[model samples]
Structure formats: structure tokens, C-alpha cells
Target: MSDNDVRQFTVGPDDDGIRLDRWFKRHLPDASFNVVSRWARTGQLRVDGARVQPGDRLAAGQTLRVPPPESAVVAAPKPKAERVPLSPDQIELAQEMVIHRDAQAIVLNKPPGLATQGGTKTHDHVDGLLDALQFDGESRPKLVHRLDKDTSGALLIARTSRAAAFFAKSFSGRTAKKVYWALVVGVPDITDGMVDLPLAKQPGTGGEKMHVDEEEGQPARSRYRVIERAGNRAAWVELQPFTGRTHQLRVHMAAIGHPIVGDGKYGGQAAFLTGGVSRKMHLHARRIQIDHPDGGKIDVTADLPPHFAESIKLMGFDLSLGNAMIEDGPPPVTRADLKAKAKAHAKSVRKERRGERRSRGSRD
Candidate 1:
């Protein structure tokens, strides 16, 4: 009956077709697949108020109620008051202030090139400096959501265990709306459309970079509207991602033939730095809307970073145009089309190889 009692989740359109266990793994990384599988088998995981198997394919708009055996708990830690000095790189990208803060959450105007959390390759990260950021008491802040290392925008931090769980649930359910502004190469034929594509992690080859496999990938959806177009070469766009796959927006845009301006990985030669545009990855998390735990809705807007704002200006986009210019249009190509095309291509190639074998046998 309390806030920590049981969590109910409604999958969104973007979450369709993914395995229940895989979905849970992405959302709750700490929880193992076997743990989720066991819970699903024991009636702990219910779909639309009914028990479902772990391998069950989750569809959009399906309500899942998960009753944890124990109430949410937070482990209190000793306080350490220390201000760490920022590196020269960190100081250079430090353009804005910590916007909103409460006992539960903190909103920061995160600058570009700063990883939200550290990994093997990363040394300095936003998570490492949480103690320095003025917060209440001894509770340390944890990242509720992350922005890519190259992307700049509003980043959310949860102060307590409950807040983190709540926000994570909201994001997974698609109740949390995220708006990103990106400068993309090439103007889309339609002003506005939804890109419903799937993305799968492509294993890295040798020491080369990795890629997303649209053929056998996770369902990822992004709704994008071209705000302003400078001929056919470039346009400023507003991207709204319904699903938060790794590089969802970037991959979706690239699939639609208009990669994010400075993305070298997916954009290939069309991505900026290859004569398309002279700028860093011109993407910015502009705003986010979510239902606050206390009550009411919290709509936080992060002012465009200098680079994003300047890029828009250079492209001759009027920021005041609003969504008025976004006309209704057909949705962007879906993953179904990509899969069908790949299948047909494979069939044709196989047929050609068979013909070659016949001709070689006749000559022999």
C-alpha cells in the first residue's frame, strides 16, 4: 500500500518485441537474468496483472506489476566533505550551473565530453564528483539517466534509492519525455515522422569500433521533426526518443539517411568533420518532463549549449519557430522494411551463387 510496496510498469510502443529478461537486464543491471527468470516463474512478475514467462515477448502498452518481497531500502554511508579540483578539460566544458535540486533529485546542465559515469577508458566522470556538488547531508547522488559523453544537456541525479527506482521506472514506462536538439545532415522529405527501428549491438572486430545491427536488434523508436532546413545538405531537428537504447537516436537518424551532424561512427562520410559540418557532435538534450514523486509534473528545460545554439544560427534556423512548421507526414521506414530487404538480398545472392556453381560444373 506504500510507495515502496510494489511497482507497476506499462511498456511503451518502443519496448515492443524485446524479451522480458533482456528488458529487465537493461533497466536493472544489478539484477541477474536468473533472478528475473526465477521471479517470473514464481508469479512475482505479472503482465497486465497476470503472471507471464520470462521469455515472453513484451508488447507496447502492456502493464506489468512486479511485487518485490522486500521494501526499498537505502544504505546510509559516512559523510566526506571534500571539494575536488576540476581538470583543465572539465573546466573548459563547464558552461552552466546545477539547475534544480531537492532531497530526491538534482538537475545539472551537463557539458559535452564528460562521461556521466566512469568506465575502463574513462578516468574523470560526473559520478566521481557527486560528493563535491552541494547536496543535503551524507547521502550521495547517483545518475538516474545518462547522456552520451559527447552530448551536452540536462542530466538527472537521484539522491536516494527510492528516487532512483522511481525515475528509472518512469523512464522505462516512457512517462518521462526527453527532447533533444540535433543538427543533422540532409533534410528529410517529410518535416516530421516517427522512426520505429530496432537496434542490436554489433560485436567489435579486432580493435575497430562497434556498430548497431538493425537486422537483429532491439526495438528503438525516435520521433524527429525538422525544425529548419538549409537546402538539402543540413537541417536542425528536434529528436524525441520513446525508447532509450544505447545510441538509439543516433542510430535511428542514420538509418533514416540523416545521421547526427558530427557522429563519425554511423554517419560515415556524411557525418560532420567529413566536409558536412565543422563542429562537434551537434546534439543537445533540450528538455525533460516527468511526474514528480512528491506530486504534479516537473518540466525542466536546459538552455541550449553555446555550440548547439551557434550551430543553429549558422544553419539559419529560427529557434522561435516552435512546432508550427512540423507538418503531419508518413512515419519513417520501420525495421520490418529493413529486415525484409535484407532477406530478399540474401536470397538473390544465394541464387546467383547457385547459378555460378552450375556454370562451373558444365565447364568442368
Candidate 2:
């Protein structure tokens, strides 16, 4: 049969009220949403063997048939005739040193500003330049994990599809560990504690931003420790995320009132260029530990990028002391300090509640 042949399936009770397009999305992972919508709109999608719209609510026990269009296979693009060489900036950023490399996977120190992979707007990415690094012949490197565009540090790439599948399963099963270093706006009340706040995507708030939601959100957990405190302005912190979510570190840090310094979108005025402090985001992926598919555990670490190092120095942190600040056990919190912080937190909470109530009253 041709690729455009119709496929039929019966919906179960759990599939009720779901849009036809969404149902198809769950069933066909590789098919784009546009393709599914087109099939529904052209009367190629049927419910009980009758034509149905893309937005039609699915019913339990309904027989669905979808005559999908022939899959369009596009040949990979060939390099242009006059290909320009990689610029010095590109070379500087892309010249990652391999920390560990085996037949299954490769770990490297990914420099800041280079994206892990190309998107709709991005053209040059680490995945595109894998051949230059002499990774497994012409086979393109697949990203096992991702760092933000501005965040620099340890990055993992799989050399083969089987290795990629193994790494993906490891991450999903929480066997992979990732640690990050950040300079937040203020010292947290607790020197070390776990933030077990659940997070969810807020509507209309564009970009990769998330918010702490008490209800209807996914569970997110992050363990944090204060590395050092600098006056009343900023504190160096180490974070270990127990769950992998987009922008989890940034959002969680902001929720705790200590937004990561130089995070313009999340930190607000704290990240602004003022009072002689440089305006570079002082966040880095410090370390990662994961089990290899070939039988051994791998530990990889990256040195702080120059900007982060400079920020730490400017804040008067002693680099010789290393990143561990709570080594000899955490110091006790004074009774007076404890009382003062409790009062401040209570006041902030009350003020926030009052504002929320006023907004709700107005809406009503």
C-alpha cells in the first residue's frame, strides 16, 4: 500500500473530550501538528467512519480513521559553493575540550553563548560542528543534555543512536546527576535546604519562564547550599536539581527571592548594570555524574567561565577556599537573626496576599 493509506483505531474511554489533533499527536510522535490538522480539515479524518473536524471532541468507543498524506521526505541541504570559514569567535566558542570520550558517549566543556542545537532561528550550533571535533567519523553528535545559551559548562553528547537512547533513559529514570553554580541576589534564610515547590507553565507569559504553582503543576525538587555571602547584595550558591525541567534552576532560584544575578529577565533590577558590578549572568553548569552504557560511572566537571570568575572575585570571594562553604558543618543561626527573618518573611507573605485579594476583588 502507498504511504497515504488510511489507518483505523478505536478510542478508549480515557480518550473522551480530547481534540482529534491532540489524540493524533499522542499516537504519532513524528508527525507535525500541521499535518494532523490538514488531514482533519480535508475530510481525510473520520469518526465512526464519517468526516470530522480537527477540533472535534473525541468520544469513547468511537471508530476513527485517518487517511494521512504521503510523508514528504526532504533531502538534506548541501553546503553552499562559497562556504565561509568559521570565524575566530565561532572557533573560540566551539573549541570544546573533551573531558571524557568513549564509543558510546562524549563529554565536553561547552563554552557560553553557543547553543546545543539549532532551532528555527538559530543556524550554527554545537551539533552542526560535531564533525570538526573528530567525534565518531561523520556521524553527527546528539545532545544528551542541554545548557542555556548564556550558561557554560559540562555538556554531554551521544556518539550513536543506541547511546542516545541509553542516555535519555538514564535522565528520565533520574540516574543522571547535574550540579550548577550561581550567584543569586541575596543570601537565603536557610543556609542549605531543598526547595520542593511544584512548577507549571503560566499562560501568556512568553519565553521559557515557569512559575511555582501549588495546584495543577508538575513536581519539581532542587537542593541548594550557600557557598558564600557578600555583604547584603549577592551570594554564591550551589544547586543540585533532582528533577529535569526547562529553566528549573532559574525559576526556582527566583521563587526563593534570590534570583540569579545577571539574569535580566528573572532577576529584574538585581541583574541590571549598576553600582559598578558587571552585567554578566554568573551561572555555570559546574559538574555532572552519570553511568555509562559501557559499564562504568563517569564524572565530568568544568572550570568557571571567565565572566563568572571575575564576578566572584569582584564580590570578594576567595577562590583559594574552593566552592564548598559549609564544609565544617553549617553554622548555627542566631536566635535574633532567626526572629528577624521570620518576621520579614511573614510581612512579605501578608503583603503578597493582600495584593492578590485586591486584584481578585477588582476582577469580581
Number of clashes recorded per candidate: 2, 0
For every candidate in turn, the CA RMSD to the true structure comes to: 10.8, 12.4
Per-residue error for 5 in candidate 2, Å, reads 16
Q: Which residue runs of candidate 2 sit more than 4 Å off their true CA positions? A: 1-93, 136-138, 273-275, 320-364
The alpha-carbon lDDT assigned to residue 97 of candidate 2 equals 55
lDDT of 2 at 343: 100
Residue pairs with backbone atoms closer than 3 Å in model 1 (clashes): 199-218, 200-217
* Candidate closest to the true structure, highest TM-score: 2
TM-score of each: 0.64, 0.65
TM-score of 2: 0.65
lDDT per prediction?
0.74, 0.75
**Whole-model alpha-carbon lDDT for candidate 1:** 0.74
Cα lDDT of model 1 by residue, 159-216, tens digit: 7655666677787776788888888888999887888877777675442333456687
- lDDT digits (tens) for residues 209-255 of candidate 2: 78888897787888889878887778888888888777788888988
